[model samples]
Target: MTRTPAEPHSVPAELGPYLREVVHRARAVCGTHLVSVAAVGSVALGDYRHGRSDTDVTVVVDQPLPGRTLSDLAAVLTHPGLPCPATGLELVVYDAGFAARPSGEAGYLLDLNTGPLLPGKVSFDPAESPAFWYVIDRSVAHRCGLPLYGRPPRDVIAEPGRADLLTALRASVREHGLAEGHLGDNRVLNGCRSVLFCRTGHWQAKRRAARAVAASEERFRPLIAAALRSYERPRSAATELPATDVRTFLAWVAERVGEAAGR
Candidate 1:
């Protein structure tokens, strides 16, 4: 059975119009196959930064979408056609079966990445991308996703087991730490959020998680504070975080998550 969309007033004022446009375009393309549209990531977590955060969205369809429909949906929802208000739009579409019972692998019908921060690409094959990110995103969606077009997230999306989440978190930490070049504030704040989730089994806004971690972890206070400051500022105006400190913080967080998983 189809469900009504959530109230537009429930989201940030700036995003209300953009989201409405997205739903309109998606409905036009997918028609009856569309099952739900939900807001995830920073928006759903209630700490969305106007210029820095990407608008992360999840769409569920009744079954696998044909190639033509996927192309049509991507054309309308992506940049230029829809114009994302945030840094970009990271939208993923999953079949209802996969949304209800996601396996250990990446299983999505469409993965559309658009805007300035991310490379513009439309991927249909799961093999084209990494699996860990999808797993973690699903965990977050199941926990706190806000329905925009259909049934509540928890009703259509299943939560990954704690162990599986921890595994994905560990992989994420490693990937962030090992990557070369600018580590950025996201690494630090994501580390804080990952550790918080490992310990409490709940998702939190990056800023809130950084503050909470700073209050308790005195050793990482300076690092987290710097990260928070950078995160709050506009992406171009933000100061650079110390790469060494960010990597060190991620290592500590990984250890903490590993310990929690062992318990």
Candidate 2:
């Protein structure tokens, strides 16, 4: 079942060696049980930035991974052993059955969060994590994933329904609005992307989606531009958006997603 990546040439030059190493380590750990490896998120969307973006990857396996395998995977894939080149590496391993018929539920076998910007945690229990974010991630991966180790993504990953996506988007927008600390750039850009997805049911890079929203929603042009500027800069140079503007933007996006769901 294993084959060359569907679009091997599409991978960024800087990521080639790192991703290959990821595959090698994964294969060494899981052996024949590993079904495939696919690159998702900004990397797959062709908007990856060296110091600003996290590399998101999804791995599908023939069956649930044992505790020993999970431990070995964490030991080898996390920092020091197999250093991540990007800001972080957000890898999720899912059973093949769950991947083929996904739902708005926590069904992952392993949720590995590593790197500088991300929390260095490896989660195995579904009940211990929030389901909405993973649900949205699965939806995006199904639509935009680029295969790196096996069969094409669309063959193994099922796209969640429009209603499910809208529900997840609404929850995400609300969470951003209520969350504390510094997520200014993430809030505004995510708002832009959410609204665009609500209207079009399509996925685009955050910056690209912001530009598309800015073109149509004149009122949010300034906010969108600010978000874009902050997002493009290195992490140390990133700027925060006004809290009031971010709240308003998220509210508007949540309303839009709600409306889409009703329709």
Among the numbered candidates, top lDDT falls to 1
Regions more than 4 Å wrong, model 1: 180-183
For candidate 2, the 10 contiguous residues with the lowest summed lDDT are: 1-10
- Assess the local accuracy of residue 59 in candidate 1 as a C-alpha lDDT between 0 and 100: 94
TM-score of each: 0.95, 0.96
Worst 10 residues of 1 by lDDT: 175-184
lDDT to native, each model: 0.86, 0.84
True-vs-predicted CA distance for residue 47, candidate 1, Å: 0.8
Q: How far in Å is the alpha carbon of 165 misplaced in model 2?
A: 1.4
Cα lDDT tens digits for candidate 1, 128-195: 98788888889888888989997788788888877777788888888778755334788888889898
lDDT of 2 by residue, 63-177 (tens): 9889889889878999756878888899999989998995877788898989877668898987888787788888878888888898767788788776777778888888889
**lDDT score for residue 178 of model 2:** 87
Model 1, residue 218: distance off in Å is 0.8
Provide the lDDT at 45 for model 1. 93
